[model samples]
Target: MRAYHLDAPRLDALRLVDVPQPRPGMGEVLVRLRAASLNYVDLAVATGAFPAALPLIPVADGAGEVMEIGPGVSGLTEGERVIPHFLPDWSAGPLPPLASRRMRGITMPGSLAECAVVPAAGLVPIPSHLSFAEAATLPIAATTAWRAVRTGAVRPGSTVLLLGTGGVSLFALQFAKASGARVIITSSSDAKLDRARALGADETINYAAVPDWDRQVLELTGGAGADLVVETGGAKTFARSLNAAAAEGTVFVIGFLSGGDLEASLFPIILKMLRVIGSNTGSVADLREAVRAIDATGLRPVVDRVHDFADATGAYETLSRGGHFGKIAITLEHGHRAQL
Candidate 1:
């Protein structure tokens, strides 16, 4: 089988190479991956920002067909379409302490390969309405958004403030709207904000134009602020996120795209009586719930671009460039042309 391996902590180290196809072990299933999606963590691992074992497969989320089922795996059969959870060990409930360290693309074989042997328990059925490229975006981004919104207790008349138009934020926007919450999303580009408004965002802020976007959030809510703030920006925007949340609201931290170092005062959180919770993507069960929600609502993931498997590096480069509105995907099957 063919796969991309990051032999070192550099984007240039990702190279395509031939490897023997792996077989399913006990309680595992062999899947012929059709598509995979890129995430910021994949870029971190490729560039040494997030340390990982060298010379490993290099993408976290993917969808494919079950080709072979291992012994003791009875519920799933060959030919079933499924997605492998990014965190294979955390099946349900609160996250286990050690599960985050053993994740796809970082510690184990990931979706870059033509085929992978994933534990059966870690796989979730793809929603009937989505394509492989769309389902490939669900394991991490969608699940994290689902966890954040659910944790924040988003409901009708609630207000959600999303930091950007990235995968998690977009998923949160769709989910929040489905739950009848008013959403306010931010971006540096007006065009992206327009697209977000089309996605049901009640309001949009061009953060570059309005540098004091937290104040803008407060103004938008008539001084009450947003009921939930999905904080994707770490050091650069964490303090502002605290300012943007409503009193006693939740600040769901999912990413550090702007760098993770923090030097902000904790006064806002203390004064507002806010809850600051950090997310580690989500569990297989969360992925299952996310998929069910997508299925139930007929919600489709927003895929910005799709690259051929031979040009997989290009997909990573596009993600690194940072202008994409949503998830970037790569098709692993031959001649499987995907619409961007």
Candidate 2:
């Protein structure tokens, strides 16, 4: 099978190579990958900012059919459509690193290959409504959004503020709307804000033009501020999120997509009693709930681009561009089931 590997620092390290196909080891399942999706992690892995990573295959979350199961594996069947949980451990309710050595697309070989051997426990059923492209993006982005909203504890009609219209924020928008909360999305670009509004965002801020978006958020929410802020912008926006949040509201710390480095006063968090919580990718339960929500509402992933598996490098570069509004999918050949 041909797989993409990051040889060293530069993304020029990405190259196609033929390698032996893998078989499920003990407690593992061999999946014939149908599709894989890109994330900031993928870009980090490729460019080598991601440390403790072995020189290995790239691309994390994906969807495929179960082709073979290893000894002791059960409750999984052949030909079942499945997605690997973002974190193999912490299966039930919360997020935790599963084992000392297992995290797909990171500590281990991932699904960028034509086939992959994953722990049987990682696979979850893909909903009937989604295509391979849509299912591929779910385990990471969707689950992060799920965890963010859950941590926010927002009820119906509560205000939710999201930074950037990236994949996670878009998923957050959909889930927030489904829960009947009003979404306030911020983007530097008006065109992106327009698209966010179409997705049911009650308010939009061009944060590029208005740097102190928190004040704008305050004015928009009638001075109480947002009930939650999906703070992906990290240091650059953290202080602002603190300023923008409603008293006692939660701000889920998910990313530093804004390139990090911000200055802020500690008074707001001290006086308002706000919570700043960090969320890794969520649990299997969160993924399942997100899947059920998508199935129930027929809300599919918003895919901004699709590239053939061979062009995976170019696809990774697009994600760094920050222009994509949603998930980027890469299609792979079937390694298990025969196509007619």
Candidate 1 error regions (>4 Å) = 99-101
Model 2, 1-340: lDDT tens digits are 8887766756888788999998888898999889888988788877767663657887789988998889999899899999987566657754454455367888787768888888777778999988888899899999999888888887798899999988899999999999999999999889989988988999999988999999999999889999899998888889899999999988888887666566788798889899988877877788888888888998888888888787788788888776988888888863332121
Cα lDDT listed for each candidate: 0.93, 0.84
CA deviation > 4 Å runs, candidate 2 = 93-101, 260-262, 334-340
For residue 104, model 1's alpha carbon misses the true position, in angstroms, by: 0.6
Clashes of 2: 1
Give all TM-scores, in the order shown. 0.98, 0.94
Error of 1 at 41 (Å): 0.2
Model 2 lDDT, residue 145, Cα: 94
Best by lDDT: 1
lDDT of 1 by residue, 191-291 (tens): 99999999999999999999999999999999999999999999999999999999999999999998999988888889999999999998888888888
Instruction: For each of the candidates, give the backbone clash count.
Output: 0, 1
The candidate maximizing TM-score is 1
